[model samples]
Target: MTGSVTLVEVGPRDGLQACKHPIATAARIGLIERLRKAGVKRMEVGSFVSPKHVPRMADTGEVMDAVGSRAEPGDMVLIANARGLEQVIAHGARTIAVFTAASDAFAQKNIGCTIAASLERFAPLVETARAAGVAVRGYISTITDCPYSGEVAPEAVVPVARSLMEMGCGEISLGETLGRATPCRIAAVIEAVAAHVPIEALAAHFHDTYGMGVANVWEAVRLGVRTVDAAVGGLGGCPFAPGATGNVASEDIVYLLHGQGIETGIDLDGLLDAAAYCGDTMGIAPVSRVFKARRG
Candidate 1:
């Protein structure tokens, strides 16, 4: 494992998008500022998707403005086509994310396309972003298990990751989107992908649905993944996957990393404070183990 880990906070976008309550725009920006205070240099501040499809992220542009100068502007929103890319660039974004799934069933369900078609769709957007001088990150969902399709093969994920890498994506984040991945399964997926992609070129996005988020994180680290993605206070879920939970919490991941003497450059106490602020204002009990322990 590398000596340091880069934790990309996704609370402002992924964490808040599925929320039933309308998190105020100021509150959302406040989360971004607070995470910055906790030493988060990169975050997915918001998305530029259609409001009709994702009402919660309708104010992503505003959140970006509010986060102005507090942190470097990065991308986490799903860009389906050129229109989405244009909106992201118009919002002053220099980085963007395009996602594809390893499972055909989930791909079709989520984006109305087969895995091949989805990658084809992202091809133009990826080319456009690269030409426009923007950095592009690739995301692969269902790296382990898909809610719709049982056990996704590691072979199924390798080519998609390779395609993203060949398409000029600087980084590819592998998603155990349902968060049900065990250490063995997580290791298997990483092991396969690492064979095709460099360890430095890969990251992991593990969910907490089965309460195995941190364990899988540790396994990823052991397998030499230098980057991890988390949401502040564990505030995200897949709308399509019923009963699945949030992203692994930022505070919790920091606590574990600090305990293991891993350097994340994050202030754990400050991150806890931010988690508290999110929980209190959002009216949801933080799903983070460390945050709950610290609060209690």
Candidate 2:
């Protein structure tokens, strides 16, 4: 496949994190293995955060330790600070992701820090990780709209993405936390960020709360985003964003990309199988459009 899009499957970490129940280590390991079979080279197995805040991810270290060797290059775990970074490194994550927000209100709600403080918090960790030959990916939420602050300007989105790149983050994933964006809104944010960061180095992570997630994703790809952050079976919602939903499903993204002759190197059948696994495991029906259609 030429001109392939890098689909970062976040089902294991970002997908399952906000759920109520804790996942068994075996189930986490099984999902990782199956996702690999679906040709996902870069995936997030879990996050290294406090179990009190994110109980589902409490076993992230154990999950990583079990599947680290099977992960391809650029596999990631979310790290909040130096402490979380240590956990990620300890469990063998060669690449890690850190987060911030375009809106300070959203930042405070999500991470309990202002935008500047959150960046400050991650500064040392990024430096230490880079010196250790590890790569960092940055995630910025509220690109176009914030749950607390409401509308977020494209101008506000630019500096956050740029700062992450300047701080040694190789790529930055722009997040639509509320999933309320239209294609036009997505374009504005992408355009503003592209002025500072290379378009190819930008990615989008959209929630599907309003059913616009897939549309916004397609618009982003058309606007020159080569990478996208998605979860298998559409399995995520930020607790901070009230009534928020999951990312545009990995199964749906792969289906769209391949249909447009943009290779994602994923097997739709394998992805759907993972979707089924998540549905059974979470005790909720799969939410992705493709998953529903296939099941029907």
Question: How well is each residue in 186-224 modelled by candidate 1, as lDDT tens digits?
Answer: 999899999999999898898999899999999899888
Over 4 Å off, model 1: 69-76
Q: Per-residue lDDT tens digits of candidate 2, residues 181-237?
A: 899999998998999999988988988889998888899988889999999999888
Worst 10 residues of 1 by lDDT: 69-78
Each prediction's TM-score versus the true structure: 0.96, 0.97
Residue 199 of model 2 has an lDDT of: 94
**Which residue pairs in candidate 2 collide?**
none
